[model samples]
Target: MDLRTANMEKNWQLLAGGDRQGLYACFDLFYDDLFRLGVSLYRDVDLVQDAINELFLELWKIRERLGEVRNIQQYVITIYKRVLYKSRHVRQEFASLDECIEMPQSSYEEALIAIQTDERRKALLQQALQQLSERQRQMVQMRYYEGRGFREIAETTGLTERTVYNTLHNALQALRKGMERVE
Candidate 1:
C-alpha cells in the first residue's frame, strides 16, 4: 500500500483500539481538510474551525463507532457537512419565526439570560449562533471571542480596516436583534 493509505489504516486501527494519541494524531492530520471544507461552504475560516472543533468533540463522544467507519476522512467530511447544514437550516427556521415567537426586548437583559453553561444552554447558544450569517458569525468570534483588533482582522482577512469595523458592528447589531427575538 502507499504510505498515505498505510498511515490511514494504521491510524484507523489505533483509533479502533481506543488509542487517544492516535485519535489526536488523526485529528491533527485531518484538521486542515475539514477546516477547508467548512470554509468552502461557510466562507468564514473562524466558524469553520469552531465547527470542526465541535465535530471532533462529538466524534470522541462516539469513538466506539470508529471501527465501523470505512473511511475516516470521509466520515469527518460528512460531519463537517452536517454542521454546515445545521447552520443553514437553523437560519432558515428562524427566518419564519418573527410572526410566531414574540420579539425579544429592545434591551440586553433578557438576552443575557439566554446564555448558560448547561448542555441545554450551550445547545441554545449554538442554535442561536447557527442562525447568523457566516460573515456575521466570524466577525462576532473575532471581535468578542478572540478579542482581535479590527486592523488585525482586516489584515488577516484582506478587508480594509473600515470594512472590518463595519462588519463587526453590523454583525453585533444582527446578533443583538436575533438574540432579542430568540431570547
Candidate 2:
C-alpha cells in the first residue's frame, strides 16, 4: 500500500482499539473529502458540516463494534450518505406550513411507495457506478454531478477532450447495461 492508504489503515486500527488520538487522526485525514462529498450531494455548507461532525461522533461511539473495513473511504462514504440524507430529510420535514401547503397533497401510502421506489432506483444506480473503473466513475461524476464541461474535465483530469468524451460514453453504456440487468 501507498503511504496515505497505509496511514489510514493504521489510524483505523488505532480507533478500533479505543485510542482517542486515532479518532482525531481519522477526522483530520477525511474531513476535506467528507466535506466535499457532502457539499456535492447538498449545497448547504452548515448542514454538511453538521452531518460530518455527527458522522464522526457516531463512529467514535460505535468504534468497538465496528468490524474491519477493507476500503475505509468507501465505507465512510456509504454511512455519510445515509447521515446526510437523513439530515436533509429531517430539515425538509420541518418546512414552514405555507411552504408545505403549497405542494400537492398525497396520501401516506402513496408517499411511502414513492420514497421506496426512489430509494431503490438510487441504490441500483450506486451499484452500477461501483461497477465502473475509478477513472470512468470520476469522469462520470465530474460531467454529470458537478456539471463540468468536457474541456474543463479534460483539463482538470489531464486527459484529452476526446478521451474524456469517450470515457464518459463507455461509462454510460456500462451503467445502462448494469441497470438493465437488474430490471
Prediction-by-prediction clash tally = 1, 0
Residue-level lDDT for 107 in candidate 2:
47
Error of 2 at 125 (Å): 47
Local distance difference test, each candidate: 0.71, 0.87
TM-score of each model, in listed order: 0.47, 0.52
Name the top lDDT candidate: 2
Where does candidate 2 have its weakest 10-residue lDDT segment? 103-112
What's the true lDDT of residue 44 in model 2? 65
- Write the residue-wise lDDT of candidate 2 on 18-108 in tens digits: 9999999999999988877776667566678899999999899989865577778898898899999999999888997677645444544
lDDT of 1 by residue, 1-183 (tens): 787767877886787778887778777878767755665566544455667777767777787888888777778788878876776676557777556565433223222233222455566567777877897788778888999988888888889999888877777676566656765
TM-score of 2: 0.52
